[model samples]
Target: MTINSAHRFEPGATVVRRDIFGDRVWTAAPRRVIEDRGDTLTLAHWPGVEGLAPTTYIDSLGMDSPAARDAARDQGFADLASGAWELGSWRWRDTTVLSRFQAGEHFSVHLFFGAGHRPLHWYINFELPFRRTALGIDTRDLLLDLLVEPDLSAHTWKDEDEYAQGRRLGIIDDALHAQVELARERALELLAERQETFPTSWLNWQPATDWPLPELPSFNGV
Candidate 1:
């Protein structure tokens, strides 16, 4: 799908992964656009909300801890005396951590970094071809994904049960299933040959400290 003329991102533009209701569930750290080559957009990582931590979800806090009460208040919950705190029992922290690489359309590749900025794994996400929308470039995650090691020596298919469940539930139509299968085949072929499309340099690549952090786009529906 073509990028919406009004929302085309240029190099250095900031973009966030579009989430429903601007939820901070998975994506909280925005990515700096490095290049916008129409069909492909390159993004560089920024420090996540957890700073440089390896994981995004913090362990749950105890229900009666002062920290938990403070966190509930900070998150806009009613006072502890009101007994309306949903997280009054526990708090699972969300963060914007890890490095990633995403290309639009067909098959989008994602690379994740571990602690100390070490290369972790590659995630191949099969999705609907991205389309530029009023809500930024939009694509639907197909649920089927392939996970690969940093050196491409080991790999595993992920979320097969989810994908099958989607199919059984009629959420994934035959056409979408075929498209995801094709993308998976192509990804396997690319990995078998050690193609340069996989950014091996990112294993050691670091963003310049002076670069500004990425900002989220406006969320007004058009």
Candidate 2:
């Protein structure tokens, strides 16, 4: 793991995501760089922060119309399978407290809060390990995911159907699927061993009062 601080992102900077093909996916709202140790990058995103989505839904909408947004909410999986998408917009409404990625790991761990901002669960997102970029990070979403209880007492796989669909659509090739499967096992070990992503102190951590809701300046950055 690289242990350089100079190569890390500054606090309160926005980041963007790109597919393996280098196509824009979505740019996050301003996220607080909780820690950027080169080996492990931790970030935080609070509610009300607005981000740009690079999705071209199947409704023939460019993501500006309410109807398009509604359609995306309804049949997003189908649209993703089509592979004919474009730029759109979305706002953070969930309790995404902390997002941490280990260097060269094929997955990331995110802590989320529930109603009233209470500690909820840890979300393990399976994707390409992030490569640092000038604007932020470069990576794309894999269809598979895992959800673990806050105490790591229970866990479940998510988006199985979506993952299968991705395979059928040739979105996740054999090479990528191999990596995803390995990541799944590693994430499961963390759960079965009751190993939380971060120390217990992080479970109770709260957002700073001064952290403003971040806005996205652009979504095309690498």
Candidate 3:
């Protein structure tokens, strides 16, 4: 699940990601480049990450110090409470409102994350906020809303072959099929929330203008 994009980076900014060891590593390019410098090594030591010792500050660059995190938290909290954030029927990242060039849409600053502007094929307004908030630092709420927490006893497949396998394995009966379907229905509710149509939204969008567009076959009282 590795993804690389031509990401915009700020000079002194750093980001951390969880590694295989369950330890946070400085994944930003500038930070890594500084780490390889000999003098920087002597200035700070990489304390082997383990239980109870989750974070190690970069004393050399005065980065990720407790003070720095606190400052960031303060700024974030201030932004969250600011009156500049507008309340609307649906929340959207401010950039998305502007970028989409919406004709009748509304927005609030609170709803927008700079990284969450990609459009999806489905229309679910409730889920739209979730998608827009997903790439931010705190995404638990969005993830939970989008995920269909599976019922362990429910049948996972509708096909006879799959049902038979479950029966043979002494798993739940095919009656569990309804439970799976119920889960699926909830998932669809999430999808219908965003009301945009594919390849047709205002953002860099163009309608299919080819004349004599294919007409649908009539159902003719079938």
Candidate 4:
């Protein structure tokens, strides 16, 4: 799909970091568009959902323990009654995510924070390019990911088993697998060389209390 210039976000626009499925909604407080340089967008995360309620009690309870199953069922009903099925009440610590989508490249550098908003590690997600729809832009997360320390002193791969499982299930094709691998390698190189793939200034940033909270759009399917 052609990238629509009109659909590009502007700085200060309230946006969300959400997955294709409406189930996993993050940034409930609505991440502000700190930088919207056409091809890239930097978002400053605010307090948001800490955890999402389980969809199925059966799935949540691995072995079908009767007590656990009953508890999960009750919780599910309570969540539905309270209308908390869509968004949880858990708050997020300080965090920031820088997204880039140029040509066919799609990735995000997520920075986690500790106490006092101290810089923590970076979680890099490589994924498919975003497709903008009427509701919002949507992208699917690939199985592979990378982890880098705050100092950029070391880096490691993450979710290798999941990636391999996707390949085995024919979900991740050869081309996509190679693409993700290359993306991981590129991330390692950047970290090793101390390259600034995303703005470091956002590491210490926080959102204003008056910033609007994000609401999930109606998901009719993509």
Per-residue CA lDDT of model 3 for 1-222, tens digit only, reads: 222222322322222211111122111110111121211110010112111111221221235566876554344223322312211111111232111111111110111112334422221111111111111110011101121111111122123443344344433235544443454465454334533321232334222233121111221111
Those runs of model 2 whose alpha carbons end farther than 4 Å from true positions after fitting are 1-6, 17-22, 26-29, 54-83, 219-222
Candidate with more favorable, higher lDDT: 2 or 4:
2
Pairs clashing within candidate 2: 56-85, 56-86
Write one digit per residue (lDDT tens) for candidate 2, span 1-222. Answer: 655444577666655434544353533445667777678888888777766554533233546777767566445545455644455566677675788888788998898986777889888999888887665676778878888777777788898977887788777889989999898888877766666465677778888888777555553333
Backbone clash pairs in model 4 (N, Cα, C under 3 Å; residues 3+ apart or in different chains), count? 1
| TM-score to true structure, per model | 0.66, 0.81, 0.17, 0.69
Residue 176 Cα positional deviation in candidate 4, in Å, after optimal superposition: 1.0
Candidate 1 TM-score over all chains jointly: 0.66
Ranking by TM-score: 2, 4, 1, 3
Best by TM-score: 2
| Top-down lDDT ranking | 2, 4, 1, 3
Candidate 3 Cα misplacement greater than 4 A, ranges? 1-70, 78-194, 197-199, 206-222
Model 4 alpha-carbon miss at residue 184, Å: 1.8
lDDT of each: 0.55, 0.70, 0.23, 0.59
